[model samples]
Target: MLRRLALTAVVSLAVLSAAAPGAAAASGPLPLPSPLPLTLPLPLPQGEDDARTRLTVTVSEAGDPSAEGIFELECAPVGGDHPAAEPACDRLAELADEGTDPFAPVPRGAMCTQQFGGPATARITGTWRARHIDAVFSRADGCEISRWNNLRPVLPGVR
Candidate 1:
């Protein structure tokens, strides 16, 4: 009787352990890829002798890459004695004009260029922002951009 009881307990434990993982996985939606944060230092407008101002730029892809995905850019000033205290956050529709479906994954090395300042010739920076900048491939539902990890002190130099 003792031997039979021990064998039954062991078999029950094995089955429960094997089924636990699958049951948990099916209980909820799959996880999504983590967001990426990129920090950039904006140079003081030319001729201004003030110290450089730090602007943190975070890029996050909304739930799947669709024409309706909300791509947000947030700029916050760090350190330095600047009057710009309000952090600017802007949300633009991803591929608004292309009419492309959003469910598709963003192409590898997808390039996006944003220009600052007024009309006429301005400083043109190449490869300013690119999707999958880290070359990480993720098949999750959506992407997000936040200051969760990439925070650092501002340094003197052009980013």
Candidate 2:
């Protein structure tokens, strides 16, 4: 009887351990072997002056070769700058719809470009606002991941 009890306990422990989360070995990194580069275009605010800024972003899986690309971004100031303590920038998805192409598949080993629009107003300085824009590109054949934005100011000495 003691032998049977011991055997049952061992089986139950093994079953419980296997049921635990993350119990299985991890699959290695994503299958993709290279990074995806992107670019963005910026827009200026109405009646306000703005210029295009170039941006580069590379997205790759762990243990994969880095892929890179350059793009343009446009932005303008509409609302005056807010308190430094609070982030003055917020991502506007509706703006992205104006100029940006919906996600499309890319050819393997080839690069493609797409444009996207941004918010109508962004705070540049205390009580100042600006317009914004973006452009994105990626290699063909990769999955269409989600979109992202970088609202941090690029101007020097402008916190």
Candidate 3:
């Protein structure tokens, strides 16, 4: 009788051990603890593009108003009173495509030629690729002249 009872207990323990995982699953998964509050920025919609490129360009000579001019330029569709809107827009687009900031300034402490370009100065302001742009151009030095010339047609030729 004693042996039989011991055998029965052993068999029952084996059966229970085998069924333990299945029994827990059958009873359904345990509830997960609630997550903490999280703040996530919403993503922009698909097909959306950066802000339109619209700008006001002002060019002035130190002592010559006849050489001074102000023009509004709108790009992406290329409109406004700019004389070379299409070409200007093309140059800006090319710069952006190449991951270069067209309005970026010359690096500090870098060597530049001491050549003087002239007394022409220009200011460009407004938006490009959704960022505020307020850049100044001048032919004060070689680096400045190169910067001004690179953005051609955008800044009318000034000699």
Candidate 4:
């Protein structure tokens, strides 16, 4: 009887050991935290897009770094220390909605003057609706002059 019990216990132990493990489910792949391991979407669209527009606006005489004046401009209900935030934001919004290139080179088809407004240069660096902006602005030509004139409100100190 003792021998039989020992054999039966051994058999039971073997069976239990041979049994497959219980299927403990797991929630696959823990969700990544917000702003976690992210990348900006590439290959931005042409014309105006939905990219957030932020700018580090700079202006100076062409080739003169010492004279450069810079400001910050933020739009979409603009909030920044920029002096002309309200009008600037409004104008910018209008241009964007109208599909105007706020930084376009002089139009080849349009007639423009040969007058030298100045050798001033402007650079706008920031993100504009998902697109990166490192645009250079100038008053070197008719188109550039037109571009500068159109953006004067946002630029400040320009008549």
Candidate 5:
């Protein structure tokens, strides 16, 4: 029968394996990857930090361009036309130190409260930490409200 043939083959394989346990090792050792070299960052040039953290923020209500307000922000030395430049820069620096990306959007399929915040929206464009950033923000829902609140002065005070 087919069952007998399968059982005989299984027993044969078991006997062969038990008879030569070291046969597998005779193929030789496997090649291992070499360890990578460690690298350290060099010091930043003078004025480099100041040059890397500049942004333009534009806020509007209900998608109305007429109501939009635009402002420039420069960190490091913290000079700009923003109403709360120092506070905004300080908050942004705190985020960077904590390894948080303020411009990240809400994750898909995330559970959030159904409450609506408002129709206010904002756009931030420019460079931060030497990387280009162009992010849009809105207080349209609970998740968005939390995101906006976390940025504080960087986005603008809105309820």
Candidate 6:
């Protein structure tokens, strides 16, 4: 069921793209998203700074001062300032393809408890795949902890 929904979404996007002005007619297979090069040059004046994945991370632990850092991730060649840039880019790309939102809030009715997994709290803010992302994650509950772990590569010192 989820697979079908994803396929439908992709197909709809293709159709909408084809309908755009000056768009070439649809060919055999719907054009797949071309992998972005490690360095993207948006010389068309999109009015943005460098076209790299730039991010900031802030983590706080109970009874400890907050730790903060930054990372720049590039996907194609998988080179950036991220410690695990290669794997991180691969994981991030996979999630993006699966339509996962890095900043998605916990699902409603999740089986979460008030138990504290740890005293870790983090805020991540950045540009990913041309979109701005600003999110906060905490280990105050099972669901939030799971979400924080999922983005471990991007958020160091959260454990």
Question: Each candidate's TM vs. the true structure?
Answer: 0.23, 0.20, 0.65, 0.57, 0.65, 0.54
Global CA lDDT computed for model 1 = 0.28
As for candidate 4, its clashing pairs are: 51-129, 51-130, 52-129, 106-143
Q: lDDT winner among the candidates?
A: 5
lDDT of 5 by residue, 1-159 (tens): 999999999999999988675665786676654422222342345656745788999998845454368989998788888878899999988777766778878776655678888889889999887878899998877878888899987876654
Angstrom error of the Cα, residue 20, model 5: value is: 54
lDDT of 4 by residue, 48-107 (tens): 554377788887774545436787878775877667878887887666666566765554
Q: Provide the clashing-pair count of each candidate structure.
A: 3, 40, 0, 4, 0, 0
The order by descending lDDT is 5, 3, 4, 6, 2, 1
Which structure is stronger by lDDT: 4 or 5? Answer: 5
Any residue pairs clashing in model 5, and if so which? none
Q: What local lDDT does model 4 show for residue 35?
A: 27
Q: Global CA lDDT of candidate 6, please?
A: 0.65
Off by over 4 Å in 2: 1-5, 16-40, 50-159
lDDT of model 4, residue 39: 29
- Stretches of candidate 6 exceeding 4 Å from the true structure: 1-52, 62-68, 72-80, 157-159
lDDT of each: 0.28, 0.31, 0.78, 0.67, 0.79, 0.65
The residue-by-residue lDDT of candidate 6 on 129-150, one tens digit each, is 6677788988888778778777
Ranking by TM-score: 3, 5, 4, 6, 1, 2
Better of 2 and 6 by lDDT: 6
Judge candidate 1 at residue 119 and give its lDDT. Answer: 15
How does candidate 6 fare on TM-score?
0.54
Stretches of candidate 4 exceeding 4 Å from the true structure: 1-51, 62-68, 107-112, 157-159
